[model samples]
Target: MNLRNKIAAGTLVLASATLMPFLGTWEGNGQNTVYADKLARGLPTVCKGITRHTSPYPVVVGDYWSNERCEEVERLVVQKGQLQLADCLTNQQIGQNTFDALSSHGHNFGYVSTCASRAVGLINAGRIAEGCKALAWAPDGKTPVWSYVTDEQGRKHFVPGLHARRRAEARLCSQ
Candidate 1:
């Protein structure tokens, strides 16, 4: 079924059908394992990037998640994220690809932050292509942003993985 049709069916439709595989590619389906998120200051994360903040259950360090439980929680979290993102968007008629891309961004960076970003401003102004490009670039349109992590020493360091993910998100948004 198409995205619009799925939307009409229920909120559960979009996350499971469209965004799951897209997110799985980037987030990595960790299956039954729980690990620390180094970038987020060692927050316990499990099953396709479910952290304590996003998880319905308390994320314990050694807890094991079954495949079914992981999928269920991921779907719930992604759907909640989609609703949060939709609330922040002024242009509700954006295409599925654009929405999915933005949802991915919202998933990684909080929806509130995504709402306040320059990319959202550009998209609201009806410059979608430029907005997509803005997801990966700074105001200079050359330097990349959102591709670094601050360490305990308060120093910012470049992360190749984040850079790649941002570029991939931009491509998805442009589509």
Candidate 2:
């Protein structure tokens, strides 16, 4: 882990005893797949053909599979993820967008993982805007908060996909 992750993890360990209230699960007719796809990084496959599948776990992109197998993976991953978020947070009466955003983050990292810890703290503190913004920073924790970096040549490096997930989460949180 990086320095930021280490710090967040240490903080969560100290705060784990506290129980956060439950928020609703990811809502939508088909939203789960959308948020999950961002995390899945895999293509869906079935009947010896590849389509696109969004799963919480890693999968071989072009592997063939039965429809049942694909659904099972999605179900299990979502179930475990919900349980993890339920365990990690308290007093979470957040809206669909915010909740889904956080759930995505929790599912990707661990619910109690340091990165989550930071976002959790901000959310709980009622700094909704800050918290939402923090979600985008949760990945490596070193992603430039200002959205840019300086190279040795004194050249400015604009971070692109590095915080794309976080940006998506932040957008959801704002809604």
Candidate 3:
């Protein structure tokens, strides 16, 4: 092949590589994808705030996908993700941040799974005692709400003010 042909072929190869991440996905957040489809069916609310799929190729050619597009994939997905249920919030940074945020609000006790995770991460990160005392809002388990505990001692515990909120996680724990 001539120099021009060789360069063109190489460029095409690179371009295809960059496009691979966006190749098979849905269309939201300007081109989202379907992840954890089952989860979406079961829980639409959680997905409402997350966009599906992470781009192995999340570049914007002047605001479009192009070049080395992967570095920002985690940032864009996590910061601005509104995914569906069973959408695998694991890799999404937005998921992590959401979880961490809800968890970290020390005085409040009503948090879902994501919120709980965030709190624990922040607490542990801060070298705080992450236990029943970590939360000042937990009440007796009778209020139909509760904060979740790590299953370390073969028993579950709750914080003061989180009554009804714990109900959701309780059901999951039983199963």
Candidate 4:
């Protein structure tokens, strides 16, 4: 083959290899799939024991049903994560661990938030550890688990139940 043809073939091979891992199915043990599965498991399909929920979409109060399956939840969560990631972090390559960690955060909250932007900036700047720490600092983008704000009635309002998730996301990012 000529030099031009060789270069073209090499580029095609590289592009295909890079995209294949994402496009291909996991069959059972993909990291992102497993991560998504674990994260979405605790979300209730029946909030307050009456209101029903569905995957890949938010829960509507009036439209409640209890027929959604577990596999459907996993698929929905993964699809949402992928879509969120695609929308926010476009045209850039990310490692599996980073992808999984960020996807977890995106799944829990959203990708187009202040926290996600900070994490993306840190990761893009090659400050992986700092980025991971930032993510742990603000899992929900607006509230860090360690923060406490005083309400108008002089009561301390705390954002509970997020520290653990933040820690988990940080752990995944560092890995």
Using TM-score, give the best candidate's number: 1
Residue 105 displacement (Å), model 1: 0.9
**Cα error of candidate 2 at position 58, Å:** 11
Better of 2 and 3 by lDDT: 2
Q: Rank the candidates by TM-score, best first.
A: 1, 4, 2, 3
Query: Candidate 2 residues 106-153, lDDT tens each?
Result: 644545662356776777666767778777664465664433545656
Instruction: Give lDDT for model 2.
Output: 0.48
- lDDT by residue for model 4 over 1-175, one digit each (tens)? 1122322344212212322232222212222211222223333332211112324455443343333433344555555444546455432444556556666566455546623567767876667777777776764545564324455567766544455556666777777
Report the CA-based lDDT of candidate 1 relative to the real structure. 0.80
Report clashes for each candidate as comma-separated counts.
0, 8, 39, 0
- Candidate 4: Cα lDDT at 1: 17
Off by over 4 Å in 4: 1-68, 90-93, 114-116, 138-156
Model 2: worst 10 consecutive residues (lDDT sum): 14-23
Q: Rank the candidates by lDDT, best first.
A: 1, 2, 4, 3
Instruction: Please give the range of 10 consecutive residues that has the lowest summed lDDT in model 4.
Output: 26-35
Top candidate by lDDT:
1
TM-score of each: 0.90, 0.51, 0.20, 0.51
Model 1, which residues run further than 4 Å from truth? 1-13
TM-score of candidate 2 to 2 decimals? 0.51
Greater lDDT among 3 and 4 belongs to 4
Local distance difference test, per candidate?
0.80, 0.48, 0.29, 0.47
TM-score, prediction 3: 0.20
Q: After best superposition, candidate 3 residue 166: deviation in angstroms?
A: 16
